[model samples]
Target: MSNTVKIQRPKIPQDIKPLDFCPNEENLFELCIIRDCSIINEDIHRIRFEQVIFKNVIFKDVSFKNIELTDVIFDHCDLSNTDFRNGSIHRVEFIDSKILGLNLSDASLGNVFFQSCNANLISFGYSKLKQVLFDSCSLRNADYYESTFTKVAFKECDINEASFERTPLKGIDLRSCTFDRINVSINDLAGCEVTSNQAIGFARLLGLIIK
Candidate 1:
């Protein structure tokens, strides 16, 4: 089976300037561009960012709960160990970002793209993802328990030791991805596309000897 599906890229704003400090009263930011900024160890909650472009930004160990992100593009950013729980992220793109150990539990993500990102140990438990694309990302040991995926694509990703319990992967293509060990039920793997070698690997997972 061929994996020729192209992921939808982010729609970035053209006219944007260096984002200054946001007003403390309102956590609402729109059409702003933030680059080379470090907001590490900061607790930012209930913030709403619209049409924002973050490039080479560092948000390490930041707490970003209950945030709303719309039309956001995060390029070459470090969002490691960031708490994005209970957040609403729509039309967002994370490209070439280091999002290792990021927490996205109970978040609602729509039309999101995670490309060439180091997303190891990332958590998506109980999250709702729709039209999301994870391309060329290292999602090793990532957790997706009880999460819902609609029109999601995982292309050329490393999903070794990833968990997908109670998450249905029907109609999802896994031909371009590689996984040595995955935690998934047989029923959840139904209607999923895989390569011949991957099929053999799956057979081994089922304790079947393939000659």
Candidate 2:
């Protein structure tokens, strides 16, 4: 019998199409499909999206403050430096995306899945994440200060130099990931799983001399 952990895949909606124009405050989107669009440096605020699907979209430096997204899926997108501060995201999946330096501070995410994404330097400070999965992602220098995580899994991810101050990571399995110089307190790392070599590195961080 195999005891390997399986990551959950995104449940994408079948009906979707290409979107041309950018969303506005007046015309809010609902149950729509947006694809192959570039919304660089656009400020999108107070918009509500329900069951929306975004595919092959590039959202460089886009501001998404206070947005409400439910059952949204982003596939093959580049969301570098996008601001999602204080947003509410539920059942959202980001697949094969470049979310480098993405700001998700003070946001609330539920049932979110990030797969095969380059999410280096991403910030999740003061956020609440529930049932979130990060698979095959690069999360170097990512910040999770004062955040709450429940049922979150980090599979085959690189979390080097990541900060987890005041975040309780009990029972979290980090053996499959690569991490070095991680900023985490001893209490925060309680019950977290690590490899033998990683335990040595963590011991070194605790001023232990392993001769």
Top candidate (TM-score) = 1
| Model 1: CA > 4 A from native | 1-11, 21-23
Over 42-76, each residue of candidate 2 has an lDDT whose tens digit, in order, gives 78777777777888989876787998878788889
RMSD of 1: 1.9
Model 2's lDDT to the true fold?
0.84
Name model 2 segments beyond 4 Å from true.
Answer: 1-13
Superposed on all Cα atoms, the candidates' RMSDs to the truth, in angstroms, are 1.9, 2.7
What's the C-alpha lDDT at position 73 in model 1? 94
lDDT per residue, candidate 1, 83-140, as tens digits?
9999999989999999999999999998899989999999999999988889899999
lDDT of 1: 0.87
